[model samples]
Target: MASNSEQKIPTMSRQAAEALIAEKMGPDRVPRKFKIITDTSDFFRVDYNDVVILGDNPYWVKRYEKEGRFGLDDEPKYWVRRAIDLSDGSTKILKLVFHEEFETKIGGISIRCFRSPKKEARILDLVAEHPNFMHGHWVLDSAGNNVRILEFIPGPRYDQLIIDYGTDHQDYFFNYFKEVLDQYIELVTAIKFLHDHGEKHGDIRRDHIIHDRECKVNRWIDFDYNYMHGESMFGFDLQGLGNILIFLTGRGDVLVPELYQQQREVFDRLWGEDLNISYKNRVANLQKIFPYIPKSLNRILLHFSIGAKIFYETTDQMLFDLAKARADVIKLSGRTS
Candidate 1:
C-alpha cells in the first residue's frame, strides 16, 4: 500500500484544469465507427482499415513524453503517452503499438509468451469494475493498431514501499505482515478469477502492483502479455506471484556478503547447509536472515529458492499454504489477524 506521502503530487482548480486540458487537446474529430472486437480467437483475422477506431480519444500530455520515473515501464517509451480526458479532467494513458515476445522456462516448464494488445483490451473489459485491476479500454488507432486508454492510478508502487518502509523490520513482520498476507490472499484469489474465466495476467510483477491508497487495493497493471503452455500453463504468472511472496515474507531481501563485511562471525555461522537460499546473489530465506521467521512460511519461500523440490500446481495450492502459514505465524505471535 502507498505511504502517507501521497500529497507530494500537486493539484489545481477545476476551471484552470479544464482550460489546460482543452488547450492541450486541440480540435476534435468525429471518431471512426467500427465494431469493437472483444473476441480473442478471431483477433488476428480483423481487417486493418475497417477497424481503425474502436473507442474515444484523449489529448496527449507532452511533459511525460521524455520519460516516466517510478514505473516498471520499459522503454522506447514514446509508445506510452499520458493524456487528460477533457470530459472529466481525469488523467489517462494512451498506449500505442509496442509488441514483443520471448521464450522462457521456469521450473522446467516451457513458456511461449507474446504481447497481446487485443487480449489486454479484453481483460480491461473483464476487470473493468474489479478493484485489483487497473481499468482501461482498447481502441484501434488511425493506423488500425490496437491502442489502450488506461486510467492513471497514482501512488508509489508496492515494491517501492518494500524499499521505503521506515519502521523496524521485526515490527513490520510481527505486526503488519498479517495484513499484507490478507492482501496477498486477495491478489492470488483475483488471479484465480482470471484463470477460471480462461484469461491470464501475463505480465505480473512486483513493480506492476500499484497501491491505490484511497480504494485500498494493490492493483495489478500492464496485462499485454499472452502465452501458450502445456501442463503448467500458469507457471509464469505463478512465478511472478511467488516473487511477490518472497519479497513480502522476507521483508525485502538480505545481502549476506554485505552482512559478512559487517559481522564475519554471523556470516560464517549462516554459511552452512541450512542457510537461506541465495537468489540473484542475495539471501532470500527470511528464516536464515531472521531466524524468528516461522517454518511454515519459510517452507513456501524454499520452493522459489535455488534447488527446491516442490512446486505449486495451482493458485489454490498457493492460497492453502499461505493460509496455513499465516495461521501458524499469527498464533505464534499471539495476535488476532
Candidate 2:
C-alpha cells in the first residue's frame, strides 16, 4: 500500500459538482442525484455514504450539504461507500464496507467485537495473495476503527452488457457470446483455484464482476461473501453459470436446449424442481435464438453449459479435466498447424 502522503484524492464539494453537471448537461437535463437516508452532521465536513444518490434525482445535493460530511464514527453498521482509492494515483475508485464496533462473550471469555477490523484484515490479506486482486483495492483508516475496501470494478453487469450490446450491435451477438464464454472459462478456473484453497465465494453475481480494460484478462469483485469450502456451494457452480450463460449468449430472454439439459439436473437437485421447470421453459425459447450457430460449436458450448454445474462439485476434478481437454485440443491443432 502507498503512503497517504503519496496518494492525494481530490475531494469536490457537492455544490460544485452539481453546478458543473447542471451547467454542462443543460438545465433541462436533470443531473444524476441521490437520496440521503441518514443524519450525518456530527462528524465530518462531508460524507458520501450518508446519502444514497440516485442518478435520476439530484434533489439530495442540498440535503447532503445541510447534513454536512459526517466522519467515520457516524457511519452505520451496514454502510458501504464507493470512494476514490488512495493506493494508486489512478482515477479508479473502490467500494468500502464499514461496520460499527461490537462487544460479546465467547467460550466463557469476554470478546470485543472486531468484525470490521477482522474483515478488512482478511480482504487485505486475500488481495495480497491473489494476483487477480492486485489492483484497485485497499483498507481505509477509520477513527479508531477498521474499514475495508474492494476494487471498484467498472462496467455494466453481464446481463446489462448483453442487453446494451444486443440493442446497439445486434449483428455482433454471436462473436460476443463466444468471447463471454471464454471469460466464463477464466472465471471458473480462478474460482476453482480459490476453492482448492478451501475458500468459498458466497456471492457470485454478474453485477459484482467488472469489465474494465484490465478485467478482460482476469475479472470479478466483492469478497464479502467469500468463505470456506465446508459452507455451501450456493446451488451448484454450474447452475449459476448456466443461468448467466443464457443471458451472456443473447438468450437472456430464454435458455438454449443444450445448456438447459445440464442446468435442469443440477439446479433441480439443489434449488428445487421449480428451477428445473424454469430452465426447460427457458431453453425452449433459446433454440430459436441460435438457429444458425454451427452444429459442432453448438455441441461444445452446450456441453460446457451444463457441465459447469455437474463438474464444479470438485474444483480439483474440474481443473484437471479442463486442463486435459485443453491439452488434447492443443495437440490436435498442433498437428494441423
**Candidate number of the best TM-score:** 1
- Writing each residue's lDDT as its tens digit, candidate 2 over 32-125 gives 5533322222323235422222111121221111111122433332244443222222233322334444443221333233334344445456
Poorly placed runs, candidate 1 (over 4 Å): 1-56, 63-76, 103-112, 228-230, 269-278
Kindly list the per-residue Cα lDDT of model 1 for residues 28-59, writing each as its tens digit. 42223323322213333332211111233234
Give per-residue lDDT, candidate 1, residue 92: 74
- Cα RMSD of all models vs. native, in order, equals 10.0, 11.7
TM-score of each: 0.76, 0.49
lDDT of 1 at 54: 25
Query: Which model scores highest in lDDT?
Result: 1
